[model samples]
Target: MSSLPDGVRSRTVSTDRLETHLLETGRADGDPVVFVHGNASSSRFYAELLADLPDRYRAIAPDLRGYGHSERRPIDATRGLRDFAEDIRALVAEIEIEQPALVGWSTGGGVVMRYAIEQPESVASLALLNPVSPHGYGGTRRDGTPCQPDYAGTGAGMANDDFIERLEAGDRRADSDASPRNVMRSFYLAPETELDPELEDAYVDALLNTETGDDYYPGDATASENWPGVAPGEGGTNNALSPKYLDLTGIVDIDPAVPILWIRGAEDRIISDTSFFDAGYLGKIGELPEWPGEDEYPPQPMVSQTRAVFEEYADAGGEYDELVVEGAGHSPHIEQHDEVLSALTAHLDDATTRIGNS
Candidate 1:
């Protein structure tokens, strides 16, 4: 809606000749702290987060290629995680920020981390907010469906396993048999994880009226295959789609010097292990045995989908910190802004103090 606060410049950066939406805030001379939004969300996702911070620090948020103002360089191909990383990299270079600190939410976590890996000299640090665990993200259904589509017929009919999987995997038509009432009712789950129903209703109401989400729900087949941000086929993940443009498979273990700050919502199903962000499924990643004597492999759960960031972070032995926010879900910036700010402020204070030291 409104531009990302004041003082921060708003602009577009061209990558591979394609333009992407970018919002810059804070004093022009301040150090750059770039923001990357999650899938199906734009830079606007960080509007509240931007407002939560102090003016002394400059904050930047960019819309990943397809979701927002950013143009899709290759629309027909897959928009993988690597491509998302490239977009951020190109944007940073375009803006002329020297190794800006990268901060992302959800899928943004992967992008910044990969960027840090590839351009270690260009990174100051990494901050993940309810980040997507390397293992994978949890969803509404037991099968990892984030939301239920309308084609399932009715109340109970829509929750069917086959139906939900097909929908998340992008195989079914979202609107074919969907009912508006059903779409809305299914938004909530047991114990009410969110603080505001109207907040969700507003989004649902907006989507119902939007061009893609509402009446038409034209449908995207690959929505379920792991968000547009991370490329599945990269490390032989075997995800249905590969990143359409950039190749980002070989950059994970970034410079040992870069510090990592990770925050997880205590009840965040999307990141922790709520029915939406299963911690059990995540823990299982460590259960798998690794190749004998492979130093390249960081540890078990090479790519944790949830709590494992702490695992990976601790193993790395940097100035690592993790926070467990009580009663929060996927979007900590929105759901628990005040608490998240305090945590972030504490980290930044120490980080800024140690600037250029690392």
Candidate 2:
């Protein structure tokens, strides 16, 4: 387990839905703020953020089922991210937290979006960091349209086998590109960011905590006649993120809008217009063979899709602010901590004020 900062405390909260581990700090009676982590990560990623939050705010980071010290519950991909969202609902309720400002990173962003959509009344505000598209991870066009009916070239099949092997073996060496440490350095943050050795080891430990199997991390996949030749299966994290089951655009229809803060690293490769993880992007870059022309299979315009949806969200009476941290990558909150924290705190304060006035 990674060492917790001085003010932060760790504990497990059991609810009917799932047993979740949480890292929490700040005053117990203060306004609540919850942090949701991305896939293959745990609450440990937010240890610093939780510790640094203003003393007037209660900051809590939960380990979603199957990640960190949380229970290894089977995810039902067919329900999209609802399982994860519901677990969060249970946790908040069990802890007596009401209408918290929800901060979600990557897949956790998708999960919270689903939660806000299902129960917008429960969310005071929403903060998304490098989130997956509202249309889900891949196999979708700019307008949230599926390129292939079967939604191929996504889900568990997209996960790297070598990386999975290394992760399963708990390989901590930064020797290979497939190693968790290397992946975090190469893809999780900007190339120029100098990572502290101890912090690197802590992050690697969090990465290795991911539960691996067909029912977990990458999930399962099946044959497809589409270009990439693989479609989403019925279980696991990746499949739940697949456009086949996840669509959060209904956020535009929430009657009473939840204020949203969208933050991302300007140099993010994982969730960008040309994401390194997307097969369509890879095919365009000539990394994958048998290039199907752009018209047939173009790279997903992920950032564009998000912008369009946010615009629609605005037009529908919701408000949002987008911040792009220059020298950061997927984890802007970590790469440029002070800057991101400044904006996040202001947002949370504003949201809390609005809640109080209402």
Error of 1 at 325 (Å): 1.1
Instruction: Tell me the tens digit of each residue's lDDT in model 2 across 1-358.
Output: 8887789999998899888999999999999999999999999998988888999999999999999999999999999999999999999999999999999999999999999999999899999999999989987888888888899998998899999999899999989988999999999999998778898889899989999888899999999988888899999999999999999999888867999999999999999999999988999999888758788778988889988999999999999999999999999999999999999999999999998999
Off by over 4 Å in 1: 2-9, 75-80, 136-252, 277-313
Residue-level lDDT of model 1, residues 13-43, one tens digit each, is 7766458777766776777788886643567
Can you give the lDDT of residue 161 in candidate 2? 99
Write down the TM-score of every candidate. Answer: 0.64, 0.99
- Return the TM-score for candidate 1, rounded to 2 decimals: 0.64
**Ten residues in sequence with the least summed lDDT for candidate 2:** 288-297
C-alpha local distance difference test of each model:
0.50, 0.92
Candidate 1 residue 241 C-alpha distance from true site, Å: 8.9
What local lDDT does model 1 show for residue 200? Answer: 53
